[model samples]
Target: MARRTGLPAVEVLDACESTNDEALRRARAGAPHGAAVAAVRQTLGRGRRGHVWVSPPGGLYLSVVLRPGVARECLRAVPVAAGLGALDACRALGAKAPRLKWPNDIVVLGPDGVRKLGGILVELCLGQRSAGAAGDAAVCGIGVNLTRPRGDGIRPKAVRDGMPAPLPAAYLDECGAPAAAGDYAAAATLFRDAIVRRVDAWAAGLWKDASAAPLAPVLEEYRSSLLGLGGTVLAVTPEGTVVGQGTFLSVDGTGRAVLALAGGGTLSLAPEQASLRPLAR
Candidate 1:
């Protein structure tokens, strides 16, 4: 009996090229804050780093527009906080507890292995807006596999280079849960509502907190949920250039990954700067 009565009106849609793009368009057109657009499928869904997302029917693909009035320095906290919100939405379905990967991935851990359940993509457009628009707004796009995906090779059956690749499934299977409620549609509704609730909450913090104190709670949650902290990892650039091997430290306040190189020195990596892969312990 999950409710969709949360703030930020959720608009259901049949299809979209990309929810984030559509949401951003609405924002520019003076859409109210928290206005969300969700599609059953996306024709051109993309994740952070512009990785193509294998979006098909039966998954939760959504985006929302918001004006989180935080300073430029504090903007990174908004998406990092979004990781927690997505995690909460998955947990709402009584699925296996998923962990947060630095930057913004929600993944489920199991004896079989870790499978990524979903991701959060946050985009900002500060000054460029139509006349008479709200403060700086961000479009947060979310995608959760609620059932098997179409035959897309991006999400392979096995983890790649020790980093688990994305896969598709209902939240129950997606999170390694053995069983779940019978109603798939109802469950999808609940998950969507849960995610929006978390998003609205985080956006509120960005609007009110000056020093980004609102992210304190999110960072705390991330610590408990973060996957590879204190483990060995190899960093690589988006172009696939190897950065270095290091012990995964923690995500810093600016949403950068802090890596302690094996030989010496520490490096902080932004999402655009690197992707991390776990090394076999």
Candidate 2:
């Protein structure tokens, strides 16, 4: 049940548990590269760990199946490249040039302050590789909130002095770019294409040449847009409590967060092991 789109073969669904799930299903069925699933409504959209993604109308929920065939070791770089692609597409479609939070969150400056406009959840599908297949494949799950006139996207962050935490979300429509023209469908299409194109580009980089896969060019762009360099950041581990607090530093080659810890030392933690959040104010 895939439909033809200008960019690739995409399955359009009215509702789904998560587009990522659908992409995984496609991958198992030996879906071709660039095959995608786009859901108008997702009943169980989630991000990063298992944080539920509120898939309201007007948000773009898409998952693209990619067969990069890179060795298991270098697979980590794909998310970084995907984030850069999402940022590029967002800016092009008038998303105020959002910053990419490590691992994968697309954030923008908003009236409420800096907030998450979108997020990415990349998953490796090892089972998809047939016995004679070239390499590993993954699903790049991306979700963007469009035209949110309401409060914030995530829970309010607590400011100093007992004030309630402010909402932590920014919307893309706020960018007001000429191309955006406040069109949701057009933006979705452009973003989907950009992300898939990047996946293809990075897969080659990750597999063909260890030195240049996910090239310097893409890394530089992603680095430039990173949020909270030299600013205080709070790191929360899967254990669900703040594990480390520190000055945000650069992402290491392995895509781990290198932070100058609040106590005293510099620590590099994998994105999966921890969720690093830049403190607002």
Which candidate comes out best when scored by lDDT?
2
- Cα lDDT tens digits for candidate 2, 1-281: 12444456466787899999999988878887777888877888887767667776667788888776666666677777778778878877665657877767787766656677778888987753354235467888998777553444432343111112323666566665544425545566676677767766777655556676333436666678888777898877665567788998877666777889878999888877876767877
- Give the lDDT of residue 29 in candidate 1: 80
* Model 2 misplaced regions, further than 4 Å: 1-7, 128-135, 149-167, 177-185, 211-217
lDDT score, residue 212, model 2?
61
Model 2 TM: 0.83
- Give lDDT tens digits, candidate 1, residues 1-281: 33337454467778889989998888878776567788877888888877777677757787767665555556567676666767776676566778776667777766655566777888986764342224677787877766565575334443232233433323445455433234444554555455556656765656566566545546666777888789998887766677889999887656778999988999889877877876667
User: How high is each candidate's TM-score?
Assistant: 0.82, 0.83
Native-to-model Cα distance after best TM-score fit, residue 49 in candidate 2, in Å: 1.5
| Model 1, position 120: C-alpha lDDT score | 81
Residue 9 lDDT in model 2?
Answer: 49
